[model samples]
Target: MHDMQKELSTDELMGRFLNQLKDEDQLTEKQKRIMEAAVKLFSEKGFHAASTSEIAKEAGVAEGTIFRHFKTKKDILISLVAPIMLRFASPLLLKDVRKLMGSDLPLDDLLKQLYQNRLQIIEKNWSQIRLIIQEMQFHEELRGAVVENLFGVGRKLAEAFVSSKIQSGEIRNFPPLTVTRALVSMMVGYVFFKFVIFPDEGMNLDDEQEIEIMVDIILNGIRNKE
Candidate 1:
């Protein structure tokens, strides 16, 4: 267990980061390929629509190889999506969350930077995000796995951040939980509207403009004050 001093590319760094979750399941190299193929196929073709043979073809493995590793297709789905969900639980992302919680940047500037960072991350990982949302609607196990493994730290961090802002009088005087929920609601709404609801190729705001406008609305309001 020694640390290396060499620099790693983003993909290599992510691969090493994910390998940390190998503590839970000892997957062979082939098993890892099968899980990745399963995720891609599941995202493209729905879980029920994708067959083991198709997964095998995508994974470049023999038909029986998938079955050898996974008892059933659902087993493969669980294995594939669980780790991807745990990407949220990564300490690397937690470091950013901690910074967000503790940073003394101006509230508007902090929020804009946070939203831009999140937008980039979500854009990069939209495939996995889509798979998680689609499957978790029906697969309680996948949903439960995310809550059990990831939400604890995230919820606490969010609560602490909100509480601190409230105490500092930077935020309006509202219940901490309510304020936290409002922040998440505003963020989710911004992302959905920008990316999905009202996405117009010709009339899109640049990331900085989009994030700043949204952060302004979140910090101030649309209502006219007397």
Candidate 2:
């Protein structure tokens, strides 16, 4: 087949697998509506809580229409997961992050910029993030995808960053992998604390202030003084 035809076919397959595709990708109108509705309902009510009838109602389609496009509600959930993961895996964001990693900035400064960029992304996709976290335990496939797409892709870069800091005596001489995990844990813990445990409106510190404090705490533990 021609390259154009192959590309079109792949786009069609991608459309079937994800609700939020690029503006130019083509999903049939009903499929588009179904996907959009499913995503909203899933994000709001969750996979177990939201029903197919409700999705159909939200999409203004017959309940059977959803079945016509998908084998099960879990199928829709699976489809939604790909797009949510894609937001983080996007080429532009990866390029920007790669640039940051390669820059001459100090470790703390680099981390602050990285955190800010990631926080912006997390905030924008909080709904989907919540959905994935809530459901990942029950869905092995989803968990695997998250591990592979999210963590697997970034592991080498993280290790390299940690190693560089260690060699320069900027951070403690822990194993590169250990340092990377610790840093990630710190950020992840902070995100949960800020967003889940005690959401910002209740917090005393503003976002920038919170970021500063978190960075300070991280540096205090990891900075090498010897």
Candidate 3:
């Protein structure tokens, strides 16, 4: 699907992301405002450059109000990640992914659909994700949270799928975790290459074609050739 096809306003996007949080109902309206403001500011300016006071000003809340909900600026940053992890780890998303894994489509087609599903999610949450990536390098705690909370569960699912594929003679007999790692690395690398290296300006890459090539590369390397 095209990006504009499902484009949501920044308010709408943050609202939806917040809805995914388990503690969403527990959050006050002021807290939601703080989060929305923080996301916009963090995405526009790097995390280090964005301050809690700035977030409070943008949110139209007192600076002390922000601390009433969050312990520190870093706590606010970690809080943003909670909704993201919840979205992917939610039962509905897990069911969709499991369905894809169990489909009888050709490996290439399956991979393409998987790529689209994941890319859609990334596109919807790009603001928080970009900010998280930018700040993760400097914060050991954020790095650990992302790796353990964001990716840990998904990695288990991927490894299990790889194992099943190997057992069915649909893929190479490499270690399931290794195969999962390679596939995940390719997808993550493609995202970084698209956004960081050659973003919208000066580059005109077709996402569909790139996904096809990625699936081809994966199949050529991992498909059972016997």
- Residue range with the least summed lDDT across 10 consecutive positions in model 2: 1-10
lDDT of each: 0.71, 0.75, 0.78
Candidate 2's TM-score: 0.78
Tell me the alpha-carbon RMSD of every candidate: 9.4, 6.9, 9.6
Model 2 error, position 107 (Å): 1.5
**Distance (Å) between predicted and true CA of 70, model 3?**
3.2
Q: Write the per-residue lDDT of candidate 3 for residues 94-133, one digit (tens) a residue.
A: 7889999999988789989999889878878988888878
| Segments in model 3 whose C-alpha atoms lie over 4 Å from true places | 1-29, 201-203, 221-226
Model 2 alpha-carbon drift over 4 Å, by segment:
1-33, 68-71, 90-92, 200-205, 221-226
On TM-score, the leading prediction is: 2
The stretch of ten residues in a row with the least summed lDDT in candidate 1 is: 1-10
How do the predictions measure up, each by TM-score?
A: 0.76, 0.78, 0.77
Query: Over the stretch 3-61, how does candidate 1's per-residue lDDT look in tens digits?
Result: 12343443443344354445335778889788778879888888878888888998999
For candidate 1, the lDDT comes to 0.71
After best superposition, candidate 3 residue 32: deviation in angstroms?
3.7
Q: After superposition, how far is residue 76 of candidate 2 from its true place, in Å?
A: 1.6
